[model samples]
Target: MAAGGPPPVLGVDACRGGWVGVLLALGRPSVALFAPRAAELVARAGAAAAALTVVGIDIPVGLSAGGPRQADLLAARELGARRSSVFRTPSRAALEAPTHAEANARSRAAGGEGVSAQAYALRTKVLEVDAWLRDRTAGPRVVEVHPELSYAVLTGAPARHPKRTWAGSEERRAALRAAGIELAGDLGEAGERAGPDDVLDAAVAAWSAARVATGAARSLPDPPEELEDGVLAAIWA
Candidate 1:
């Protein structure tokens, strides 16, 4: 832990400038910050990094070589109408491709469906996180997370509105409050750069990270698949 308190947990989400991270301790949000990279965001926790319990991030951690990940399929199934939020992760080969056309071709050749434009757009962030995890030293247990899945588990149903909408943002905030984390007052520059949805997503990801620390979270695939580099391919909530 950090000094005398329990270990801190983190939730991170990709934002316009870079990444938004929420650090929680004793089940409450302690700080929120924005960083240009994942490592810098984690370093925001300082001493806590050495004893950080879990880190939940809204990105695909492990890429499948053969086809679409079962974890993504299961998360979509769980979301029902909100299933579209869970994009199919491109195969490792597709992720390494230089262009969308190349990615789609690689995906198809690997027995996976064509990559969606949205999913393709995230290739950089996905690969960044993947590489980070591979080179990570012993600090926190990082896991793949989906904000929609976290919100669904918290509210006991899929979110009724899109996160970018006012109603949807309100719904997500309510879910966070209901789970005992409140987001109020000023959040400094972090709040300025990240959108409301990005903040909310990071908050909920922290909630899931707490659950993971306490052994209460559930993975989309109970037995998470392992990538060759040893990253677990599963979405936890």
Candidate 2:
């Protein structure tokens, strides 16, 4: 058989009890939830590996040892009041802690501003993706994405309400439509399948994956940083 064409783009968002993934391929969108692990999630998205191009996720990748990552800083500056959406990623050392208290302590010891309870809650998920990327032989095409950042770009203004609210979800849907992304299926239905916020974030991630594949997306740091352990760190939208 002839070599396959580029892989389709995928967008993933962490959900209530698992992860929500959106696969946009051949102009079709499919959603799935992966609770077992991040590796399984990526594998599902890469079922057609030869055709996989970009995988966008709403989680922190490539961490900073001290202070905030260049990408987080940039995202905060652009997001204004909504900047809290961009949580500071903990250093690898800090992530070794087994508890929120320990992680916060470790984060401070590592020279960061200390991990928040919100950031601590995501430790397992972040570590899952971090470990998955570390073990990938071909390196991962994964990019960090913030749905709010994508929405801001789409609407030319910061989001006014939380994504969990009906108003926020509608705003997101409007932004998606404004960006020209086709939502063939009902967004509310998609949210029912996962969560309103999760589905919406995944949709934005998928849209960003398309942008990355087309070279139209801009990353926070322009050129991303590659950690010595093979993690590529950058937030794109």
Candidate 3:
């Protein structure tokens, strides 16, 4: 750790075990392939994670825009993202990146359909998940992820996995891999996408947490309760 620097974030690809990757910003490339469920990821880390600061997730923490209702409008206003806009189901670009066709299939299995009968299942779930973490902690900067931007932040260019979109399978996985996902093992399976997305998003959120901790990415938007705590911990940890 650098002097006067917060602890490094654990950037997780949130994929399957085979592709379940973990990268800690403790310096040096500490990437790996150990797939763990989200609850397990937290419980397993136990005191260690509690001791740290942030968690970024690649999953949607809020619901998607279903037509244009009040909540949808409010959410869009809050994130500053429009309904069905580029950030629409922001995870789309993450999942459809362009490497693993398998991840898209698996992500669908995780309940995120490529389309919709009502609202986007995954997006709805993001709202639930976001609420879940918000309800649980007084610490850890927990936030939704937009991997296209995440890759941009990490690599300073559109370099992650070939820049994909939810429009198709080929593009999604490519982008997921570029974001550091694996195509065969843990990330390749169906049951793992939930935890994988959560973990990776947590990682990115953690990175943002790091920036805030360093007093570098100084931007603020009256976030939900406890979210700021998570971000600060992720950065300081």
Best by lDDT: 1
Candidate 2 per-residue C-alpha lDDT over 5-106 given as tens digits, one digit per residue, 9 for 90 to 100: 224777899876677777667534444445456667678777744467888999998866656678888998899999988887778777768887888887
Off by over 4 Å in 2: 1-7, 29-35, 48-50, 182-193, 226-230
Candidate with better TM-score, 1 vs 2: 1
Candidate 1 deviant stretches above 4 angstroms: 1-6, 27-29, 47-50
Taking the tens digit of each residue's C-alpha lDDT, what string does model 3 give over 1-237?
234446644443344332232434443332333433454454333343335455545554433222211222333443332223223342333233333454345445545544332224343334445556656755555544344444345545443233222242344444445544433444333334435344444444445555544555422122321322242111111
Candidate 2 backbone collisions, by pair: 6-51, 7-51, 7-52, 8-51
lDDT of 3 at 87: 30
Best by TM-score: 1
| Superposed Cα deviation of residue 17, candidate 2 (Å) | 2.6
Show the colliding residue pairs in model 1: none
TM per model?
A: 0.93, 0.87, 0.46
Which residues of candidate 3, in runs, are more than 4 Å off? 1-4, 12-36, 46-50, 64-87, 90-128, 160-206, 218-237
Indicate the TM-score of model 1.
0.93
Instruction: Tell me each candidate's RMSD, in Å, in order.
Output: 2.6, 4.0, 10.9
